[model samples]
Target chain A: MRRFHISRLIMLVAVVAACSKKPPPAPPPAPAPAPTVNQDSIDAARRAAEAAATRAREAAAAAAAAAAAEASRMEAARADARRKLDAAVYFDYDMDEIRADQAATLDAKVPVLNANADIRLRISGHTDERGSDEYNIALGQRRAAAVRRYLVARGVSEARMEVESFGEQRPAMQGMDESAWSRNRRAEFTLTAGGNPIRVP
Target chain B: MIAGSFTRGQPRGLDDGRAVAVRSYSAALTSFWLVCVLWGLRPSVLPAQDPVASGVRIGLTYDRSGKPGVALTPVVGANADSVRLILGRDLDFSDRLTVIAPDSGDAPVGGLNYVLYARMNAVAVVQAAVTPSGGLHVSVHDVAGKRVISVIDVPLPEPALSPDWRHAVHVVSDSIELAVLGQRGISSSRVMFVRGNEIWSVDADGEGLRVVPGTVDGLSPAWSAAGNMIAYNTLPGAGGPSKIVVRDVLTGRSWSTRAAATNMNPAFSPDGGQLVFAAGTDGFDLYSVAPFTSDEPKRLTARKGSLNSSPTFSPDGRKIAYTSGILGHPEVYIVDADGSNADLLTSSGFGDQLYRSNPSWSPDGRLVAFQSRINGKFQLFTISVRDKSARQLTSEGENEDPSWAADGRHLVFVSTRTGTKQLWVMDMESSRARQLTHGGKVQNPAWSPRLDFSRQY
Candidate 1:
């Protein structure tokens, strides 16, 4: 009985030591030697050891699964933020004022831009092919400025935004009808810097 | 009898002021008489004016209904056919004279058959002979007085069909017009325009079409009055800002603004000492900088919230005409060079469709030509600076971007009349337009002043 106590104590010590290691092995190490022990007790001791080993394995696996899930969540958030940042705000024919319908489209970008403090955006304004190219350039610029002003009013830093105008040269849609003109007259957002792994709000 | 006393290579009887005035009056009267005769309106009696008593004035009358017929004799040289063709076309394009082909039975170089020419309704007969020293000796003969009026010797370079050779031929044509009409022709000038992403130039006579070197992705090219430099805007890269570039065509040297904003629509001052352009970080305004120098630009217009662009200078460089969107839409406006005395130039006659832009001030400071949106199409219109009267120059297919010739009598604009965007030159007096470019989609034509090839070479 005294020997059994000693061996059991030894097994407990060994298991504890293994568990303290940096990375515990998938399968537990062998148990310490037992001298002159009864078969029932030995079997019970062996079962107890196996149960402890199973518990250790499950803890390690759960930790690994948790880490993988966290990484995937971060990736999804980054993609969503990038999409919001790249959304375009459209304008009316020969008009530079942003329509009320486009407010939400531009507002969605504010939180993402505010969260990613390192990010810089380029707001390029475009116009439909209706007026002189020179005049259209100015009109397009006004559209982009309107967008920048909207973002500035919504807590996005003015220093983080840059504006440009493409006039009537670069069109999103190629047609003479309103369907194309509406799409062509827009302010597009481009990530000029710090876009990788965009942090979401 | 007067034809026998003429010397070669000299203007006869033009040295004295009285003689010049009398000769000019006589030429004018003769031009009128030739027009009447050509239109089959024969006057029963000549005006009761004695030729000798009028101090060397040729007896004739006055009417401005027709263009006098001028004949170009076949040139005698190695590249005679090309010379004759170009010269003949130049005269015809002038719109000041009617070019007639020389008959096979016409007189030789010095011995022109004035009686025969008069019967053919030719008031002035042009005779050109290629000299042995690679030059053209052109003589103008007055058929009415039967004398050689003026002679011009034009120097030609070697190897025909070259740009230099063509320019020399155009100079000869201009000399002929000067001798006949008391004004130089625009044949020696060139037109600068934008095609695709490049800037191209062609002779005023629609010859020597070529892309301007170093002008890739160029737009809205403006030629200086001196014809030595050109100012244009560069089409920026993705998300980049446009910049204004001024280039010296003779030296191939260039100067550009180093601004990180949209800078475009550059117009040279009349003196070629400064350049006015539209540039801003958000809304554009007019700014002027001395071209080919490191001088900082001066702000000409600074209206906030409203965009101002497309600047053109008056002849005296004291007034500037431009387009402004101050009233919710674009309209033509004029201001002093210092950005004062702003006045609305275009009338609201079109009623609520008031889109007028691209204001090009005429060289004579008389009119400001611009494009206005009318009935869903852009057409060319000119507004008088004196009377504020507006005249529509084009009514057919879409015409825009009007650039006046140096004479202020011709306008070059982009037109879609022939199913494609091409350059067309319109004579303001006759309302006749001739196609200037046939290849590629062209726009933003700016006609150069009478280019002096003598200074360039």
Candidate 2:
């Protein structure tokens, strides 16, 4: 395609030069005498023009292939981000220990952290109100640390993570009974996005 | 089933409908009071009397230093005499304990079984210069619990030094007894109540009677968790709404939080960070104070036309149980610290007919104590926090505004048994009660936390 564009520009320039309304190129051209119109020369000229057009066509095809490849690469990058954003790990009531089923979730998040070197994360630990305040605060801290440990062990930088314990102060479900408490006991990971907590002390 | 001991067989006549209703109501009241007493104590058998050797064992320990110093010292002078008498009193009080005084000039007092140690510390001396406003500036506790457990700082006039010294000495001596024995000295605390239009407080032994002297008639005196202030409701004028005021017990400085003019029954959070009270602009609902300043209180309960009142926090300050009439009648409801997850906890059949109000949590958070009206009389009761079992505590007369002592072993309440309302404290386990206020109609007594008598506050 690039070759084609160059040839088109050359042909247009040649035609304009030949069709110039300038005075005839001095009589020196006549003195040279009219050479015989050789059929071989005309055939050679036609073959040369055809070869250049073929090169131009090949260049256009190459350029289109490169553009398509770039677009596909961008699309794949977008899909991988969406998958990471959808990753969420849940916990059981009064339990800070990770479950066997959550192993898959941790595995999936590992690569996302690896790819995004600048990403920082915060692990917010929470608990249900079944125990004393002092005990629950400790429980929340443990849960948050548990999640942080998993991520760090999977090669996510420990410096990129921060942990906070909400205890039972903030609940996912506000109910008086056991069911409500069960919902509140959880650890959530929030991506720091541009706010790189890792760079902070 | 333990039957008579645990459950008293639903009053009497259950087959006849009218008698069943009447008896059921009374039985419910009985259940309420039983719960109150049980939650108040829920007795457990003592550890089988510890195999007594046909007698008793006495232990004695005291501080012998008369001055503020870091190191331990030997007993001497007047402190030696007081320590001896204090040990004698303990031995005399317990028939099981026999006093065995150490032999004089004993060989270095080596390896004595349960050594009777004593220290006469001069750190007990405290000077309280009365503030211009009658407040006291006491900078006396040069030594806290680490120095000595017997003596603490108390405010007294200079001329009464002799009696004050003896009284202060006794206070320390009693504290030593408590520290060694896992009980209280009960000598340095005071109990406050309302009589007619006056607020009054007396010592634990009911001596040193004095009026608190405040404007307006008062009711429901609640102690701040720190024991530095008392909050109560008072009607400033006839036909006016009641106002809740927190008074500095020592300084006489006071501040009031205005509710809907009908607000009352204010209780402090376990940490003294918030005050929970009932205020109904539409109908009474529970509220909290942020920053816990005496000036402003933040409303917590949703104003949904439900009569929510009498808010009290659990021992650890996680949950609050209050009385609400959302189910067409007043029943106790427990909610989280921030007024979420509200669940109705009480269901006596007489809730609609007779109001159930004044909910207080036991110190251990195992049960809730409240007052329920039955047969036209309000009586104290306890509801089990786990199984919702109701137990009644009083049978003689109208009993209400029950407050649990810090130990959760006893309750102080108001009863009209003596032809008028008077303060009464009862040991829930022993079925024994004694009138605390004798002369006037005393109501709304708040029990303070265990006194830290090791140092002057």
Best by lDDT: 1
Per residue, candidate 1 scores C-alpha lDDT tens digits across A107-201 of: 88988987889999989999998889778888888899999998999998999998988888789998878899988999999998986768879
List, residue by residue over B91-160, the lDDT tens digit for candidate 1: 8788777665543435436587675566445688888877888888888988778888999998897666
Model 1: interface root-mean-square deviation in Å? 1.1
Clashing pairs in 1: none
Superposed model 1: Cα runs more than 4 Å off: A1-73, B1-65, B103-108, B238-240, B454-457
Regions of model 2 farther than 4 Å from truth: A1-201, B1-174, B183-187, B236-241, B258-260, B290-296, B348-353, B451-457
DockQ score of candidate 2?
A: 0.00
For candidate 1 chain B, the 10 contiguous residues with the lowest summed lDDT are B16-25
* Residue range with the least summed lDDT across 10 consecutive positions in model 2 chain A: A24-33
* Candidate 2 chain B: worst-modelled 10 consecutive residues by lDDT: B15-24
